[model samples]
Target: MKPLHLERCLRTVEADKAVLCSAARVPYYPLVVKKARGSWVEDADGNRYIDFLASAAAVNVGHCHPRVVEAVREQAEAFMSYTAVYMYHEPLVCLSEALCRITPGNFPKRVIYGLSGSDANDGAIKLARWTTGRSKIVAFQRSYHGSTYGALSLSSLSLPMRRRMGPFLPEVYHFPYPDTFRPPFSGTDEEIADYHLDLIRRAFADYIPGEEVAAVIIEPIQGDAGILVPPVSFMKGLRSLCNDHGILLIAEEVQQGFGRTGKWFGIEHFGIVPDAVILGKALGSGLPLSAIVAREDLMADWDAPAHCFTHAGNAVCCAAAYASVQVIEEEGLIARSEEMGNYLMERFRALQDSYPLIGDVRGKGLSIGVDLVKDGKTRERHGEAAAKICYQAWQKGLLLSFFSGSVLRIQPPLVITREEADRALEIIEEAMRDFLAGRISDEVLKTVKGW
Candidate 1:
């Protein structure tokens, strides 16, 4: 079959049989992408899309970046795999050294590699438990760490992601996320911070002992749930609380790391150094690589052989990650992300002024989110409406992701130019306007909407 025909056939079959995620069958603009380069993807239908989603925040330096491609190619030609067990390779060592240099804090650090965000979180959990000789873990509600059993247990999202997946790994606890837009504590940022910290203190008194709590894992800037940026004092308070309780703080930077949030690591923005940092997604520029970087002393407890994986430090993946980091650093992508983020936020605020449905617009760097509501006063979630906006954007040759039902997340590649960003914003505005004007029927719009 011809490629286009093949894609159509595959999509048709997938629609019928695939038990897909909420966004999967929502009128896919084009079923297949033939190639991608420099912030755009060409579909099998001969249409091009500006990749605002960046393959769900993996292609930070742009899709198929030349340096990363070259690194992968070079490693593949020479050697593809080396067991981290018997022998060592240059790529793994160099990548670890580079990570030490870039990760926050002045303390000596150690690195552990994994294949994806889920595995990285798994490794982090083990490291925390082993180092502390404790079993309890604390996470926040509506936070998404990963989907594996271990990571999923640590995550506190709604059902199907965790429902009937129990009895989940025991002793994992959840706290309310610090959402300023919809404060779970019902007060100002400072009051919210105090309330959250008090809740943690109460948790120690009522549930897990503070000394037995392995770690308090959090996303510096919550993704998936929404681009929820906690107040600076809230984060610092959490850090201080962790220190006081003698619990390790693990910052999950899986989505917000690697210049996505205009910082080397999202935790850096809060000026707090976590005991361990979980990184993935953009680390390998779309290749599968994730890591746990922590203080050398903390990781030393995992000296035994049982803690390692067979493909822990795959050379090709490490090489790709090293090259991706180099591009982000040498090209000044962090600063660029900050600048583009500010420009996009400004545009979003302008949209907010004109559209009452835009209840919130918040984030840092290239990661931004617009939460839709029926009315700003009520803040009733317009999940269906947000999904329609995303579908319309996709139809207009711009790809974005929907999160937490009502949030339309805009996370373009760091390599996205100001011109490209403007074009994307234009498409978003057109979609929002069309949806608001009732140009599309409620039935069609509802089909695209997930609510």
Candidate 2:
């Protein structure tokens, strides 16, 4: 795990073209990770980087959390896979009950498990359609549901993920997401909400009928779309509209759920309850596990076997998820996320004061985004600068992710302490300063600006 070993790994990656090199021009960061513990990941070169990405927000409690690892180990020794066809397992039932208890809504709820966010979303779609006897679904633009066909069709982000697939599912509609950063309407928050609602009403009037629409899926905080936090009024307005129109509201919390947004469910931030909640990412503490928790009456319409996965509630994943939930509660990670998020936001705002390239800095809890722009007036994307900053931060023993072309996404593990957060802020500031100082090439700048 010396520096030489790390350089060797990077060389191998270069030779093999295995580091998603085709998508991005830059070579991947040098440091092949050896192992991770808590909030730190060690490269093969024996350098430790504070992991702000948190494995794409899947490890909220931190890497190798003792409780979660122990649960997985104990479950592994007992039994592994049990096909959903024959018998029901205790872990599955227990996890379902736990999810029902924690999810919003005082009414009785049911849970359906899956191995990934895509599968859970697929299940949610089926459940919505079956319950309403309708086929049409509405999703926001720039939102990411998953990569699979049904889920990808719901996703309206990058065209590469959906284009050429041709002939996606019918009756899927897209609406402008309430992006205040690039406001859909130039007005107050209430006006923006009303404008978006009008857009939805017009969609229903011109395209899909209100009764024909089965569900309206939304990510309370659009993650892959660059941590776009919609106005509180917008969310509440949507909820009310959905209720009045009899459209099921499906909150896709794949990236922002499970304490990532300082709440068990991001929709809770608006104090509105959704009809169905899709959860993944941090639910299993790094293991692949996802679920759709819905009202019992609504879920009852799903035809058996057709809507389930073999590993829907795999024993080990359920155990890990249970342990993860426990760790979040027992350790008070949700409160910690709020405290740390406020601290990070304060630091980020300070950065904005010093850097004109930072067009906007916003988020809730530990889920945050620092948006980069070429000139403060134009809001021209400075994605290249953002990428350079990410690379520089990697060089300085920090790891983060970029989204929405120009957003520097910071989703550190919920267990991240204030000290660790300060360190991450320092790294980000240094990277931003370096990019502003012409340390990066003009060509690179143009590349990020999408010029």
Top-lDDT candidate index: 1
- Per-candidate clashes, comma-separated: 0, 1
Clashing pairs in 1: none
TM-scores, each model vs. reference? 0.94, 0.94
Query: Distance from true position, residue 177, model 2, in Å?
Result: 0.5
Model 2 stretches astray by more than 4 angstroms: 1-5, 15-31, 441-451
What C-alpha lDDT values do all the predictions have?
Answer: 0.85, 0.84
Tens-place lDDT per residue, model 1, 78-124, is 99998886789999999999999999889999998888899898888
Candidate 1 displacement at residue 421 in angstroms: 0.7
Please write out the lDDT profile of model 2 over residues 1-451, one tens digit for every residue: 1223457556755675654645334333555668999889987667788999898899999999999999999999999878755687887887888899989999999888888998888888888888998899999999999877789878999877676787887888999888888885578877887888889988778877887889999999898888998889889988888887899999999999989989988899998999989998888888888999999999776678866667777899999999998899999999999989998988899888988989999999999999999998778888778778887787687987688888988899998887888888888888888887867555434323210
lDDT of 2: 0.84
Off by over 4 Å in 1: 1-30, 442-451
lDDT of 1: 0.85
